[model samples]
Target chain A: MKAIIVDDERLARTELQRLLAPFKDIQVVDEAVNADDAIEKISKHQPDLIFLDIQMPGKTGFDLLEELDNVPYVIFTTAYDEYALKAFEVNALDYLLKPIEPARLESAVNRVLEKSKKEDTPELKSGKLKADDQVFVKDGERCWFVKLEDVRLLESEGNYVRLFFHDHKPLILRTLNYLDERLDPKTFFRANRKHIINLKWVENIEPWLNGGLLVKLKGGQKVEISRRQSIKFKDILSL
Target chain B: MIFSVTSVVVFTTRLLTAQDFSVGMIFANMVNISTVILLWSAIYFFIHYFENLKRSEIERLVWEAAVKDFELKTLKSQLNPHFMFNAMNSIRALIEENPERAKTALTQLSNIFRYSLRIERTETVPLEDEVKTVEDYLALEKIRYEERLNYNVEIDPAVKSIEIPPMMIQTLVENGIKHGISKYPKGGELRLKAVSVNGHAEIVISNTGSFSEEEMKNSKGFGLDNTKQRLNLLYGSKSEFNIVNDNGFVNVILKIPPGGRQNESYNS
Candidate 1:
């Protein structure tokens, strides 16, 4: 797995790199000094995993994750931030404290390896987000690593996009138009100007006013397909 | 019985001496004796009451001092875990890059830890010793922050021997880095200058950053608050502490009166 280490301190970055030397499967693709640098490096390499420090000069680890559309697996690295630790505990996210123990590092890497194995069945399709891909959503103090397949609906509110999955409805800073271009069209269909419905989650559909269609999701969410898209939806579904 | 006997003696004496003992004279003598007794009793009770009150007041003050001393010790001994872990990580990395410098860095880290532990033993330390500890601190931070953190210490020899509250200056300097330099992307400079002026030790710590009153009000300034409380407890209103922003630099000025307070329990 390609991994990048992000920390403001050169010593800390070098130390992490030294520790990961024994892991043959995990390749250290690059190192970033801060959040902006990490963002740039992440886009360039598209690494499968990242060893992210929670504190930096400009932006924090959470801020970096919030910016990404499809977040890679993150194993947070913090010195001893009590607030960040509480967030990680609440989310059950993996993290390694600084001066990391080799035994702990081994376990964290192994956990990520096992998770990647379960998701290996999905083929990477033309650089677009797949159903098995994970996206990080943080709301207030609560954060979750949600899979694309689990999200039943994406509703637009102003410039933010609210994702509906299970019982959570987290608003991410993204536009519905921007998400529509990135999301796999075969799985997520743009229902209207403000709503995007996951095709696999469709439960029942009924004809509605103005030749639009009212579709019910398995999770009981109702979405109205626009009159213009209903014909396209029917053609796609019937075929 | 004494009164009756005295009256009988007076009556006999008057009869034997063949003198006219009037009722007015007897009444005047009785009044004089009662007045003397009342005066004696009133003085005795007042003395005892005041002694008890004074003793209790002293005890209350002593108890308050003890509690404050315990709190100061706890506050002084609390080394920031964030700084400690980051320093350790930096030293660990240095071990492979330069063994000699890493050893020195390790020693610096140990010295800081030892200084904090020792601060619990005394309320105040010489300016010289505190400066040495601060140097060790900035040295380690310099390693962690590298070129991003720059610091200079200018201590006047006259004030080096003057004693100030332990960790007072160090805490301020740490704040300069945590809230000031660390917040900047390119980082900034930190300056610590100590001088004697008008029988008081004036220590000023300046860092490159803008202090926002709004942000400071929103977030509880833990280190700053603790330092203020500590200074108030140790020196009362005698010590001066002021923080201000001047031309994008945050300056924390602390003034300690000469011969800073000497409490037996705290000193020991």
Candidate 2:
């Protein structure tokens, strides 16, 4: 993972860079001292991650995030205690306390790697799509501003995902596995290898062939949850 | 041989050699006058003592209330300085880590400082306002703690209009981070939920970590005892505060009763 350490303190920046040198997974791309400098470097390097300090000369770490068109995976580096970070941690960001411990930094970087590995899509900062999340979908000639809750089903076809909503089925270039990464599991279920269905749209469920379960959606679309997934379905939704 | 009305009493007593008819009548009149004087004096003193006792009772009640206000204010004073001190440390770290991030934290730090300065030493502020301040605080801390911390906040629509003590919830959260999450190598989450129950606003904060009996007794961890004191001062028995550790997680729940406070407009 390519990363940058942005802090006003020269010693802290140098110290952290030295500590991070031992970690082989992450490459320290370039360092930026202030928000303006960091912004310029970020746009230039487009580093996959940033080790950010909250307090700086001009703009704060948060202010830098606010100004960004796309935020990288952020692991905060500051002297403040964990209590103060509660609000922003709501976003899928992490932080490392000061006098950065090598082990802690290693674990935090490993988490970023684990997440990227799980998504296989490094561009989407961090976090799952909620019910009313707005996502842009362009299918050849037509485009969409589909609300996540409005879509009832997602079916996989090799590298593409077919979004099935009311009277419209738009195929998007994103992989079904990618959709699985962004969708909340409790609401969006991975029913089978080729399909993930919205639980809210399920009209009925009955026994299917080969001991699987057939789920009838509100729009008359029937999906088969593979036997392996049926067990998970029951576990998640209760018997 | 003749003794007239009042003079008859004195004359009869002096000339007691022979039995006199006027002697008994004069003695009776004198006894009645003296008895009236004694009764009046007794009633006057009794009333004076009772009035003095009543005044002291009232004075004692007022003094007790004033002391409570003072104690609550004292606790409030303690909260901000502690919060400020941590914020300063955060800013200091930012100064070392990234001047840009420190600059960012500086703005938030100052805003909080201004808010604290302007805040009316109120027992409670608008819930929305309190949440905003908490957000700013967390943002600064987010920069400081980085990846070790994670948190979640859920607010009920009904509780948005309610009010709560300025730093009450924040203090508990701070304590949670200080004594619990900060101590752990891999820091954990802090979750805050605000909901309305039976017309009262209930705020529940849970953070990942537990407290030893020693820690709770020695430090009160900047949470338990002062919180209990503040609640009593502001809500008496109408409000409730509880802190419990279930294994590794610590939960602090506060409930504010309805109808105790008059409606105040929500601060933006």
Candidate 3:
């Protein structure tokens, strides 16, 4: 996996690169000294992952994540222990304290590999999805390992998407288009540009104005299905 | 008796009485002039002495008042910046995961700034306003701690209008959360109670945590120390601050005079 290291400290960036040299699959595409430089390199290189530092001069790693429409998998590296809880809250793929251990780095890489393998797997004959298929969301002090099935709807807000699950609605740093590509197309239907409704969670459906449809989910969330996607919705659900 | 010889002489000179009358008038004028000079000297000396004493007393009072104002301003300045740093840190943590909650925290933080900027200009604020500011601070901390923090406030309506130092309760509540509750694994509860007793407004803040003798002795941390200094400056002998530990709980109690309530009501 190609990755970039973003840290203000020169020694920190060098140390992380040295430690990562052992993993042949992980390539150090570039290194950035701050959030702005990291953003530029991330757009240019399109690295599969980024090893981001929490505290920088102007903008923090969290600020970088907030700026992006679609964030690559991130592993946070920070010297301060106070931010460990907050790192977890941001749904970081992994967090490494300063003077990172080799074992920890290996474990994080293994998790990424495992995720890639799951993505590569072929579809099963069974219509029901497994619990292992989940999405991670971090919003400040709260985080959740949400099963894809539990997510009732994805509401778009400008360049971000709000994940509605349980009693919480958390806005993730990914656009609706990015989520559409990642989610399984058969189970998660794009109702419109602004919304994506889970097919299994839909409890009631009715026709609306201009060939559109109104869908009510099991959790009582109602979403408007646009006229453009209603034909596709019918074809998929055969309704 | 002295007039007998003079009367005989005056009778002989009766025909020349006009000259004698003129001499008598001249003597009376001389005595009057001397008396006026003596009275003017005494009056000038008295005015000079009193003016010097009054000038010295006024200077001393002005200097004392200035020093007291400086100390209060310093304390107010320190409290605001400290609180602002913590609140911003909390807001940063909340922004990504719970934007809605973060927004609420930001709003509360704004309220704190509003209160801080105005509080220092006045000697006291209504007990109700002070409690509201404390609640805003606690709400921000609650967002940071998530489900770990809880608080309960019990204040009598009578004392709500009673005025005390602007940040008295806020400082204590902040200490309860920062020094007491945040250190624990499961976090702890903070309770604020206010009551009026014998024309004095008493505020009690209790939190579930214990501080050892060592921590209390150090006492160099800015929050509690500033709170104590501010209390002393504002109320002097009339105010009291006591910290007690009983059954693993730390409690802080403060009391201030109730006369300032009317002054605060008009200002608010």
lDDT of 2 by residue, B134-187 (tens): 677777666655666788888898888787777777777777666555555456
What value does the lDDT take at residue A71 in candidate 3?
57
User: Which candidate ranks first by DockQ, i.e. highest?
Assistant: 1
Sliding window of 10 residues with minimal summed lDDT for model 2 chain A = A136-145
Assess every candidate by TM-score: 0.83, 0.39, 0.41
**Candidate 2 residue runs with Cα over 4 Å from true position:** A1-239, B1-70, B77-86, B89-100, B212-214, B260-268
What order do candidates take by TM-score, descending? 1, 3, 2
Q: How accurate is candidate 3 locally (lDDT)?
A: 0.75
For A1-239, candidate 1 gives per-residue lDDT tens digits of: 99999999899999999999999999999999989999999988888999999888888888999988778889999899898888888879999999998999999999999999877744433677889888888898888899999999999999999999999999999999999999999899999999999999999999999999999999888999999999999988998
Give the distance in Å from residue A168's predicted Cα in candidate 3 to where it truly belongs. 52
The C-alpha lDDT values of all candidates are 0.88, 0.73, 0.75
Tens digits of lDDT, candidate 3, B1-268: 3345445444545544456766655654554455566567767888998998999999999898888767657775335443465456556545655689879888988888889888767877899998988888888777655566799999999899987878878877877876666555467899999998997888899998886768877876677777777777666777888888878788888887887632222222
Candidate 3 has what TM-score?
0.41
Candidate number 1, chain A TM-score = 0.96
**What TM-score would chain B receive for each of the candidates shown?**
0.71, 0.64, 0.66
lDDT of 1 at A40: 98
Task: Give lDDT tens digits, candidate 3, residues A1-239.
Answer: 77999976554576677789889999998999778899899878877778988766567677777665445667887655465556475555488766577899899888877776667332323323442355456687555556677888999998889989888899987789877876778788999888998888999999999999999999998888999999999999874
